[model samples]
Target: MKPLADRIALVTGASRGIGRAIAVRLAQDGALVGIHYRAERDKAEQTLDDIRAAGGDGFLIAADLADPAGATQLSEALIAELRARRDPPQFDILVNNAGIDDRKTIEQVTEADFDRMLQINFKSPFFLIQKLLPVIADGGRIINISSMASRLSFPTMPVYAPTKAALSTLSRVLAAHLGPRGITVNAVLPGATSTDLNPLSDPARAAAVRDSVALGRIAGPEDIAPVVAFLASKEGGWITGETIEASGGQRL
Candidate 1:
């Protein structure tokens, strides 16, 4: 039997990039995925199509994580979908991968920028987990897609880095809170991946990035997906409250 033959997984920001890769990987491992998108319906559909093409199954969910009410909206949609499918309210995996990045220096930061960053990157995930706790199956997995910026300082990512740091801290706290139930909560920090969010379109900049990595190359989203898939599998049950950095030893 497949390791995740009967599992259910929700991956936010799954319309593209790292989230899309993670969602597809989970489906490949036998999970029925819930692919969440904020505004990119077409991209979300493409993700579902990829899942189907791989002989896996999935559905699409839409919710704007930037809004204060977004978490509630997403949870309601998920529960409603499960009910419509005549399945139980519980699911096996939650991947909090939806987030935004503001490439502004501290001097350029404004109140609106800070609030929006906090709302989408940290607050939404926090409350989403709170709202879904009741339905998250015991022995389940919660994987937060954090960033290497949370640990390494980047002057251009002042606000974005902190938000990811908060998420990583939340993972640690929740792991202990949910430990007795046998659930595992973890944070995955991917460094300089070749996603739309971190485009490597500029040859010079891409080369600079590649040279910095100990692996001598920039990572693709596929490189990070397996890490998340492992964390979501039954084999990953014993691990919790940990931050797994898939950075290819950049700057090490």
Candidate 2:
């Protein structure tokens, strides 16, 4: 039997990039994925299509994580979908992968920018977990897609980095809180990955990032998906409250 044959997974920001890769990977592993996107319904549909092409299954969910009530909106939609399918109102994996980075310096960031970053990157995940705790199956997994910026200093991502740091801290705290239930909570930090949000169109910039990595290459979203898949697997049950960096040893 497949390791995740009967599992259900929800991956936020799954319309593209790392989130899309993770969602597709989970589906391939036998989980019925819930692909969440803030906008870009077409992209979300393509993700579902990819899953189907791989002989996997999934559905799309839309919610703007930047909104204060985004978490609630997402949870409600998930429950509704589950009910419509006559499945239990529960899931095995929750991937908090939706986030935004303004790539602004501290001096360039404004109050609005700070608030939006906090709302989407930190606050949304916090409230999403809180709202979905009851329906998250025992022995389930909660994977937060943080960033290496949480550990390394990136002057251009001042506000964005701190939000990811807070998320990593939240993962640690929640792992303990949910340990008694046998649930595993972890944070995945991917470094300098090639995604639309972090484009590397400039050869000089890409080369600079490439030289910093011990792996001597820029990472693709595919490189990070397996790490998350492992963490969501049964074997990953024993691991919790940890931050797994899939950065190819950048700056090491």
Clashing pairs in 2: none
Q: Give the alpha carbon lDDT tens digit for every residue of 1-252 in model 2.
A: 778898989999999999999999999999999999987999999999999999999999999999999999999999887777645678889999999999888899999999999999999999999999988999999999999999988899999999999999999999999999999999999999998878898999999999999989999999999999999998888899999999999998
Which parts of model 1 have CA positions greater than 4 angstroms off?
none
Q: What lDDT does each candidate get?
A: 0.95, 0.95
Measured with C-alpha atoms, the lDDT of residue 200 in candidate 1 is 92
**lDDT (Cα, tens digit) per residue for candidate 1, span 93-156:** 9999999998999999999999999999999999999999988998999999999999998999
True lDDT of residue 238, candidate 2: 87
lDDT of 1 at 124: 99
